[model samples]
Target: MSANTDSQLAKRTDMKLFSGEKLLVIVSLIGFALAAGIAVYISIYGAIILPEGNAESAFSFNAAMGMFILSIAAILPVSGLSPGKRASVRWFFIVAALYSYAVETIQHLRGINPRFSQVGTVVDQIAGGLFGVIALLIVIATALFAIPFFRKRQPGERPLLVLGIRYAFVSTMIAHAAGIWMIVLQSRYTGEAGNLIVLHGLGFHALQALPVLGWLLERSRTDEKRTRQLIHTGGIAWTLAIILIGLQTALARSVFELAMLPFLAGALLLVWLVTVVIAAVGLLKIRKGSMVQTNTVSGEENRDLV
Candidate 1:
């Protein structure tokens, strides 16, 4: 009985795209698309259609957030899973996402922006703290699952996809923390909450962007080793960029408004650039060595044949 069960499990493991995977993927894609569309629509038509002080606009924004959060929760279980592999962490993401949505909903309904709320001045502070802690936990979980790939890749895991997920999670974590801190500590600091909230949104949405990039790269038929390297570099660079943005906002500055911390943001970008150059050079050297080895093997085979 044990042997039969083991054999069946092995067969399932070998199969790709198990039942519901395709559907889940589709749902994820739709959710991402809707989120993007809503964002754009709000940006362009927001002032006119759902102008500030409009209760309807607040409701609309909260509704969109609910949809976005639900979509994210749906994908969380499937994001790291490969065929037949038991989910390592599922309920954590779901609970976190749901709790975050609930808190945000309350704040939105109250017409108080979570990021702009003063310390102890409003109920939004409570919501921000709760949601911020959850986001931080998700970030930690993502790092534990992702950052170790510096040495080797996991079984049934596409290193690139995992890296993307990790990048997005970390970005969201930093954004959340920064927002909560502003509310709790820097309420007197009078830079617009829009800057901080924008950073948070960018980081949170990386979950969609990176995974989509991975899918496109695969479809492009790029070399596997190169693809992995590209994804790794991109993920790292992207995460660093977001972190830099978070730092700037934490300092009460807008994105790219680095006059407040003149050299810091540029220095972060420079560091990322240097890291990318180093990675590219290393990849070139490895590829060169591989070519030399292959040519040497071919010559040896030819001499033996002669």
Candidate 2:
């Protein structure tokens, strides 16, 4: 029985899409399209579709969030079998995406805004803290499961992919926290020069690239030299940008505040654009039949050793 089970599992592990990763890429494209469409649709025609002051007023938020959830429904399928694989992280992404929608729903129900409320203030400061702990636990679980696969990764490879993504996620969470702080004590933190605050620009977006870096590092996707170069350059750029923005955010003069808003927002948006482009490049490389060039573990190496 054990032998038969192992054989079956081996077949699944060996499986790859006929189109390689294009299958997943197509799914991602569709998801993004649907999410954008849903968001725009609701934003533009919502008042016409759902009358104001009716119970339907909040429906747009829920509906838009639902659409976002649908776009990533492939999360479970993406994770495949095992807790440690990219698929597992992919699944967590699905959870995060869905939870984002759920949070939005809760926000709408709270009944107070032309914009989103901070989770820390309205929900519980403890809620984000608790959720982070939970996410860390899940990451640990997935890492343990993936250890076998990860062990095969190259020793010298930089995890730019994973680093990028993790940073992005963390930055966003911190963004929410900062926003909450700003809202709760708008007077003190809003215009105050003395208060310490991270710049709200490229820093958050730059952070997104960390997870991508980590995943790349974990997978041993490319040359050590090239990876190191990427990390050094990208990290420096990200750091410098973050510091500049943080400084601006923390110490911009009162009159210049509104003027700086667009630049700040644009900087963050640019970071996201750069991150997305990197992911696209990664996908392109995979499609172009690039290999990770790791000597530590190859199909033959792992097959014989493991």
- What's the TM-score of every candidate structure? 0.52, 0.41
Residues 172-226, model 2: lDDT tens digits: 4444444445445542244655332344323333433544444444344556576
Find the number of clashing residue pairs for candidate 1.
0
lDDT of 1 by residue, 1-306 (tens): 688777665644443222333343443344445445545655765523311122333444344444445435434443544433324444454455456545544454444554445433545566666666775676576556444433354344444545555556666566556545545654424365326565656666665655545544444445778767766666666677777776676666666553634356456545545544545565567777889999999999999999
How many residue pairs clash per model?
A: 0, 35
Candidate 2, residue 278: the lDDT equals 61
Which is the leading candidate under TM-score? 1
